[model samples]
Target: MLWVDKYRPRQLDELHCHPGVTDLLRKLMDTRDFPHMMLYGPPGAGKKTRISAFLRGVYGQGAEKMKVSTRSFKIPPSNSTTVECQVLDSPYHIEVSPADVGTGSRDTAIVQILVKETASALQPAMGDKHVSFKVVVINEVDRLSHQAQAALRRTMEKYVGACRIIMTANNFAKVLPPIRSRCLCIRVPSPTNQEIREVMHQIAVNENITVPDDLVDRIIAASGRDLRRALLMLETAKIKHYPFKANQKPPLVAWEEFLEKEICDTIMKNQTPKGVIAVRSKYYDLMGCMIPADVILKTLVKMLLKKVSGDTLKSKIVTFAASFEHTMRLGAKEIFHLEAFTANVMSAIKQANTSQQQGGRAPSPSGGS
Candidate 1:
């Protein structure tokens, strides 16, 4: 088993980070019935972990006994075509995401149909008494179209008596305001470097492995504040070499290295039309590797931020990256936006260099240009 799964917290108290969030969750459970929740945070920040722990707290051991099943639902009105959605089912809750159904109008139908069916079903009795409602966990709720989100909002209101909806999303802004108003929104921030270091040491002790302090620092830095990635990097390091060297670099995922060396370096060295075309080909190569367009754009921006010097240039790069990313999300073709962002970066770099060169040749304020 992978270390990430093996060491996952089974209960709320077992969670390593987010102690304040843990305390709040425990207080909610004390109520016996709590409001619907939306847990939003960056990837690998333990949103899913907290959701699972919360479920376990509510349903006992039965919540952990999960099964995966694919079910098809017929579209309304015509009732001709069908959409298949995969769900993780436990005794007390069902988890599904609209993205699993695909992009477009179908998501609206899937959201309405799946939640209606699950919520309408009768809840099974636990040991002594009947559980009043089931929980529907909608993963990545932010990815749903506005129409789909509207349908979800209605479903939440209609089925308030039958089930609770717990959603997980990376960006809170993408979720509709109506949906936000109905649920108790919780933001799970990424772990700090100190918190990450402490967790790594604990895991190392449990595994009976010795990790050097410097090696741990390198892993933490490379991890981008993602704890899951940090743990995976540590495990990979162990497999690659034991009793590690002091100067050994932690392994970065291939895509990150490619973005830094092949793409970012190329942009910095040659900011020309020809350079943009060359980088476009590399973007396709990354897409071929199944890396998401947003991820590629995000990583490229992060790398370029480090290489580019002035504050003004950095701010401009970030603005354009955000605009392009938002466009990518709304539109169908990712390649166009990806190329656009690359070209924009190249132009910015060229302009910055030209300004610097002119500044170097220009006379001081006391003299002439």
Candidate 2:
């Protein structure tokens, strides 16, 4: 499949992020001082990508061995491994096997097997004098049970040789306090539109996909700061023409058609920007192809350029965009956040006009750019 997985970013530099995180990961790699880490972030972000790269860099072939220390290699894959993490009780060597969750009915059976087997099997590894950390990497940490977590905690403490446990989850509070307390938490934030745009352009060239210049914003907008999702969306956009890949390939989705069905009607008539923003909020997550809040802002910027005089909307848009970027960075709520953003654009233009009209300085409040 081109989507959901195939377009995953494989390199550290390719990660959609600010420079600060890249710097931290580099330092951790240099010193091998990574503590048991918990990575929390929104969906489709680069949490998994960075985690994989960090581990690969640190533990790759011919990688440096830790000094005067012991380590337990724990890599959680969907398949079983021969790794020593579950060597004793798990003859197959994967703590949680797919069979456990493969069927709807057997989930608890799988969890129990993992908790019992992993807890006991790890005790001997803790005995190694040079071992300093029994590192366990659990994916979907939230899915683990209260019982599973209880058993897991003992291993962390009893295995004093272990440095820590690193788990990834979309929600942080679901983790037990004992587990959370033992490690430092890190948040992997979403990618920005600019970051997503670079990845999209690269994807278009690599895959020979076509997207309109304006719809380039649509692609970036749809991905919601997720690099993997963005690239995968590009790939999927091509595949949606599948069966037709040999003939009658479809044009990339247009900017307007890609907007919400409701927003489309309002915006085409050049309705109030406040009214457009108000309506888009209703179906924000429709069918995985609808535009995002940030993208809505961009689309409106395009509209302002077309609708207003001297394109006075340009300077106002540039300013509003900066504020919206920060608002998203702070994890603002979408409906209220977007409403405020659209409302401000309308108000700011009014202020600029007021300053212009009253003795060359007067104002009027209007929607959008």
Candidate 3:
């Protein structure tokens, strides 16, 4: 088992970082009318961990005993078509993601089917106990299609009294307004550098390894403040370079950084239609390898910001990137928007250069003319 999973905080009190958020969850557990929750944060920021701990806090240890099963459900009036969904089930709750509903054409049907099933389940009578409602945990709620989100909103309202929905997303902005308005939104910010260092130290102690200060700093730097990533990097380093050295760096792939540099340099050198054609192969290779468009755009923008010196030009470039990123989200063809972003930035750079060049050459008009 990966060290990340083995050392995951099992209970609410076991959580080391984000004490304030955990306290809020504990208080909510004490109440009888805890609202449906929407936990949003960066990936590996402990949103899921806190949710699991919160469930265990209210529903006891049984909530942690999870099992994965592939279940099939037929769309109403269509016995010919069925949706196969993988669900993580436990005694108190069942976790499902709309993305796990296979490649069925009618993806919306799976969401409706799951919601109806949860609503129809008999509410157990745990008189004076906290486990009255069955919890339905949905992972990656932001990735759900608009149609599925709409169906989920109606089901949420209809069964609000019987079942509780706990949704997790990397970004809450992607969630529908109706769904966002209904749930109590909770932001689980990423862990700080110091917190990540402490966690890494604790893991080192548990593994009976002596990680040097320089090595620890290297892991923290590579982690991007993600605790889980830091832990994984630490383990990877230990296995590859055991008997920890004083200056050993974590073994992590630099392909993202290299790709970012390649994209930015390609745009900077050739700010023309030819450049767009030149970079098409790079984008194709990435997309063909199943790299997400958002990741590509983000890395490109970040690299451009670092490589470009002028603040005004950087701001303009970022604005253009944002516009294209949003278009990528709404549209199906990711490469079009990505290529458009490169072309747009190149145009901006070329226009800026033209204005600068013209300023130096054009004669100034006489003030007293």
Candidate 4:
């Protein structure tokens, strides 16, 4: 197993970071009956870990026994087509992401089907008598369409008796206000740099490996406060070389390196329609490989910010990037938005150059107004 999963916390108290959030979860578990929960945070911030620990506290060891199955459900109205959805099932809970069932109205149908199927049934009599309701975990709740989210809201209200819905989202702003109001929203912020360093040290001790302090600092800097990524970086570094060098840089995954070299470099050097077209092809290549459009746009913006010198140019690039990113989320064709963002950045750079060039031109010899 990878170090990220191997070092994962099995119980709430076992969790090293986010002590306040752990305390709140412990209190909720103590009540034995808590409201629906919405856990929102950046990636690798222990949202899923907390959920697992909370369930285990309520359902005991049975909650950890998990199995994966692909279940098919018929779409509503016509009831003619069936979509297959992968679900992770435990004796105590069922987890599914509606976005995984494919896009459009089908996601709404899957959300309705899964929630109704799981929530309408009463909890089976297991060894634990105090546990009366099962859990329905919906991952990537923010990606659900408006219709799907609306369906989820209705099901959540109707099935409050037999089950509880726990949702995880990277961005809570995308979730509808009505749904947000129904659940007890919990924000799990990313771990601090100190917290990440401590975890790295603990993992090193457990593995009996000597990780130099400088290498640990490098990993933490590259991880962006994501503990999971930090752990993965450490393991990858260890695998490459056992006795680590203090100056050894942590390796970036292939896609990140590719973006930096191929995409970002191309954008900086070429700022024209031809440049936009060339970048568009590369964008297609990346998307064809299953890299998400948002990840691509985000990395491109970050890299470009570092390359560009002036604050004004960087701010303009960020503004345009944010606008296009929001558009990408709402629109179907990601390539269009990605290309548009590239063009906008190129345009900004060109304008800045024009202003600089015109300002640099000396006054005419006649000095006439």
TM-score of each: 0.88, 0.49, 0.80, 0.87
Alpha-carbon shift of residue 180 in model 3 (angstroms): 3.5
lDDT of 1 by residue, 299-360 (tens): 88888898899987898789888988888888788888887877777777777877764323
RMSD of each: 5.5, 12.0, 6.5, 5.7
Q: Please give the distance, in angstroms, between residue 330's alpha carbon in candidate 2 and its true position after superposition.
A: 33
Q: What is the per-residue lDDT of model 2 for residues 101-215, given as tens digits with 9 covering 90 to 100?
A: 3323233334333444444554432221223233445566665666556655665565434334556777777878887877667877787888777767766666676665565
Stretches of model 2 off by over 4 angstroms after superposition: 1-7, 61-135, 160-164, 208-210, 241-369
The per-residue C-alpha lDDT of model 3 at residue 10 equals 89
| Candidate 4 Cα misplacement greater than 4 A, ranges | 127-129, 269-281, 326-369
lDDT score for candidate 3 against the true structure: 0.80
What TM-score, to 2 decimals, does candidate 1 have?
Answer: 0.88
Alpha-carbon lDDT of model 2: 0.53
Q: Indicate which candidate wins on TM-score.
A: 1
Ranking by lDDT: 4, 1, 3, 2
- Models sorted by TM-score, best on top: 1, 4, 3, 2
Off by over 4 Å in 3: 77-80, 99-107, 123-130, 212-222, 240-251, 257-278, 326-333, 343-369
